[model samples]
Target: MSTQTPPPVATGAGLAPLVELRGIEVVYDAAILGVADISLTVAPGEIVALLGANGAGKSTTLKATSGLLVADRALVSRGSVLFRGEDITGVAPNLLATRGIVHVLEGRHVFGHLTVEENLRTGTFLRRLGRRETERDLDEIYGYFPRLRTKRKTPAGLTSGGEQQMLAIGRALLTRPELVLLDEPSMGLAPIIVEEIFEIIAGLNRTKGTTFLVAEQNIAVSLRHAHRGYVLDGGKVVLTATAADLRERDDLHEIYLGLASV
Candidate 1:
């Protein structure tokens, strides 16, 4: 009755992807490629940035794994989605949450009418266990984002953009997800707030071995936190490199700066 990886993943650091994608594709309603055959992995203790421009297939890749888009409307089209070495092509999105993969969408989707505690409780949809365990995860999430500690009694709508983003993440973490698909965690925040959010993301990966596949338009911001990253160009993975290698490249600067064509 445990959804914890079926046979369960190796309970140690540096473990392989709680979830893996191989040659993943997503075709549009008009048969255009939203994401044309991209392969990536999210191993324990790693944070990978999925980066691109406005129309790049970064969001599509995240959607595919989360199983939000499936069949004719938005199909995998080809290849496999492996979670703990098991193929999970076209799995239900809700079912995925139980299986230890959580997706926090681009817009902070906290329940605006609800208190911070209520928003956090929503993550417990998968785990139908004791209240003590729920409280433990709740406290653990707060430990990561101490700003949320003070505002736990406030309604989510009253929170600022950055705090709302933290709420979105804290809610996801409350599920105790092994891998999380985070879409633009730094979007629409002040520069300082953005820095703080990314710092917490980096710390989570370091301390708890939380795996992340993050989609972000802010290339520099994502690069600084990611261990490795993929650059999606026109629905295809045109570049895959370590974050350090990416930062070292004048080619990257030229392309992103409109100084040259990639």
Candidate 2:
């Protein structure tokens, strides 16, 4: 892993950060280290990518932020996670969701047996929306994911991989989140589907002003849509740069492959 400190990358510099992780260290089962001293920030209305290969701690970082670590028998053993300057480290995931932080975990998890629309309705449960309000929100979600509209009555497990990914995101959005922690959204999808998914994500960021912290191994797509990024390696942040700067780095491939230092 690179020992050099990543240069500070400005994101929404004039505004307060929406999410901040300070020297975060994660451990599993008390002894195994997941990630170490990882610090990063996502400013309001910005799309930030957490880029790294599998096992590079991208997911660990996201889990730590969303407080999903406890479910996996992991914990942020050091450092703090803050939201709008409030210390929320180790808070329960459900409480985090109510506070406008929603995580769409990797693997396109959905209620396999539930109808697509049924699965989507679960997102509104946390908000306790009235019937009419629920229908209106569902309509809005369907507008963003027209494919889901077409498959509203179809079982989620029967949908294509790309569709499942879309459903997962749509469900998270129904929570009306301010910061979305998206993990490996492009995984197992075709190139065209991946592009479509990213396009929608970008559109949401543009139109709805929803901030995103995306964890991805697909550097090309992630950087194409994100404003800034932090690259991780061996459970540590190795580089931080604007998306354009990272795209121009000749050694980015080497850095990802552990063949070069930042």
Query: Who wins the lDDT comparison?
Result: 2
Q: Which pairs of residues clash in candidate 2, taking residues 3 or more apart in a chain or in different chains?
A: none
Candidate 1 regions off by >4 Å?
1-17, 30-32, 70-72, 253-262
> What is the Cα-based lDDT of residue 66 in candidate 1?
87
Worst 10 residues of 1 by lDDT: 1-10
Residue ranges of candidate 2 with Cα displaced over 4 Å: 1-11
Q: Estimate candidate 1's RMSD in Å.
A: 7.0
Q: Write the per-residue lDDT of candidate 2 for residues 123-236, one digit (tens) a residue.
A: 999999999999999999999899999999999999999999999999999999999999999999998898889888888887888899999988888887888999999999
> Please, what is the TM-score per model?
0.87, 0.95
Global lDDT of model 1: 0.81
- Backbone clashes in candidate 1 total 0
